[model samples]
Target: MATATGKNAKKTNKQTDTAGTKSSQKDGGSYQAKDIEVLEGLEAVRRRPAMYIGTTDARGLHHLLWEIVDNSVDEFLAGETDRINCTLHKDGSSITVSDNGRGIPVDKHPKTKKSALELILTTLHAGGKFSDKNYARSGGLHGVGSSVVNALSTEMIATVRRDGHEWMQSYKRGQPTAGVKQVRRIRGHGTTIFFRPDDSIFRRTKFNPETIRQHLEDISFIHGGLKIFFHDETKGETHELHHPEGIGAYLEKITTDGQKKSVHEIPFSTEKDDRGNRIEVVLHWTEATDEEVRSYVNGIRTHAGGTHESGLRTGVAKAVKNYMDVHDIKAKGVTVTNDDIREGIVTIISVFLGDPMFQGQTKEKLNNPELSGQVEGLIRPGWKRGSTPTRRLPTRSSAGSCSPPALAWPA
Candidate 1:
């Protein structure tokens, strides 16, 4: 009986030891440098293109166009280029964007010892947008737009006409297939990029002309005097987008839609704080109760309203409340609110600064706290000037009560 008990204990100890070894093997098999994976250069971008371009859907397809177009727009803002052309091939496989800006530097980079054009195309965060000397204000602030677009493209061709020569380079899936070679002697200065989206990375590869047209129109409206030409080889149609009046023209189109009646004959516009950081505002009110407020920071649209928008609202509200109080106007048992002042109003607020802080890569909103106070201070005077009446207020109304006078905005 004693020998049998000892044998049973030994069996239990063996089973426990075997179970512990299996558990250890499962938890800590091997930890070494080989276990870690490092993605170099544009490999990380190809592995996670969605993270850079937002998504792999139709919006991402459109974003590729915008990224390229924005580079041209930055050139326009820098006063280097006035004209840009975009063409969509009939086969729905390729698109080309050409701009009349100073062609990308063709000289070899000092650090990489590669052609500046090649360095700009192959490396991430390599561009003039990072330096204040090359660009005072730019839409492509991150400097990753072009390279990301190049990485996701299956085939890309870049052409530059500068230094009395036309240079050309080709790439396949972000790798240079050919060196920067001279195509021919040329007179003009500009850069052209032609690329085909990779089918494996995107769910759809076709280019949408209408969507591209709309985006170009918005960009043209935002930056007046920048001409954009869009040609669709598929439909043999061409469209030109140019707005000289800037956001004021955009507001005019919004007011003429026939759904709203304008309270002012012309929009009120003001430019202030012009020493370094500048704020520009254009605003008008309509009969409908819907509010349309568009804000931008350094040319990038802020769909998500930021502190700058908040400042505009606060300034307008304060100015309107002051006008109402001075005029002795009263709503029955109701306190005036910011919404009440903004009802049926259309406003465009644009800020130009040395450095802008955005929340994320997409730049949906502005995060600079100083802009809120600056915008408020800049726009309050404009609102006061627009709301102040030229004529004196009446002593009393027919019913022995005071009523508010009609509000008018300047042309």
Candidate 2:
């Protein structure tokens, strides 16, 4: 009888164990299609802000400025605007960017039935950039910059002066608090955006003035005639950056500040391709062994570099090699490489391409393969132009005299 009781107990324990296993699987392991959550509109941005703007840290904080400034830069590129103003509030809580470009459209959007300004600020992937009619080439081609900034901010206000009137709208965490309303009549045409980044969404909300100044200076240098002004209300200081010489001034500053020696006194070259793509390069060799190359496509800086940089490297190497060969100079053992030619070189390559292809959302690198061939073709002619067997190391004087080949526009 005791043996029989033991067997019954064992069966009950086995049943309890099975029941526990089933309960655990049901609670922890059950995943079905119903479990998938579909975030709509700006919700997706709020859900994964990092995917859009990179991070919620200092880098992302500064990206907000870049996005707003890029819109104004695009205006300058399109021959519409001449000035951009950026202001940081005293308490380090908000920033305001204003541009003299054509203000954002205030008319009702045909598709959304809302003011164009409202649609752009609240909806993801909505803007004038998608169409080439408004912009031939732009840094904010993705149309995500403003909206992403809006979604991540706790409060946003958009004010536009266009069509002889000033219009305004306000938003709270990506949702419109009110429709577009006329603020008053205005004399100028432009748009002003003010926003306070949500402290809850970001790691920190303090704005760095130095970082803002540096980036604004870079933009000013890239766009020759456009002026950028930065005012820090907190510190009661102001800075205005205008570079008429454009990238030439930029190169001068970098080389002078770093005290880098240049192989050429005037270190600048420019060429244009048939497709309206313009290439400008400024380079010099420094005493330091490090190599620095900064490249930009349209107005967007590509820190990672891409095919354009490769083309520049290839062209420089080929040019140097050809010069050596023509002079009967031979390397001792190993072949002279691009690395050898690029040692201690500081180069800035700026290309204006109609439609630039970038590798990722942040546009850290350019990936267009055609740009390589175009740049190579443009640079090779300058090197090969008056070469003879007796020519010595091509000096700055001789190199400058060689005019760039006639631009070949696409048929």
Cα TM-score per model: 0.89, 0.87
Query: What tens-digit string does per-residue lDDT give for candidate 2 at 1-411?
Result: 344368798998899899998998888766777899998879998888889888899988888878888888998888899999999999887999999999999999887788999988988778887767988878887888899989999999999999999999999889999989998988999999999998988999999998898888887888889899999998999999999888878887887778777654545365675477788876656655667888988878898999999999887667666656665665434354567556667878899877788886778889888889888776666655532222112222322322111211121
**Model 1: number of clashes?**
0
Q: What number of clashing residue pairs does each candidate have, in the order they appear?
A: 0, 1
For model 1, which pairs clash? Answer: none
Report the lDDT tens digits of candidate 1 across residue range 130-215.
77898888778777888898899999999999999999999998999989999999899999999999889999999888888877
Model 1 misses residue 410 by how many Å? Answer: 5.8
What are the RMSDs of all candidates, in order?
4.5, 6.0
Clashing pairs in 2: 274-409
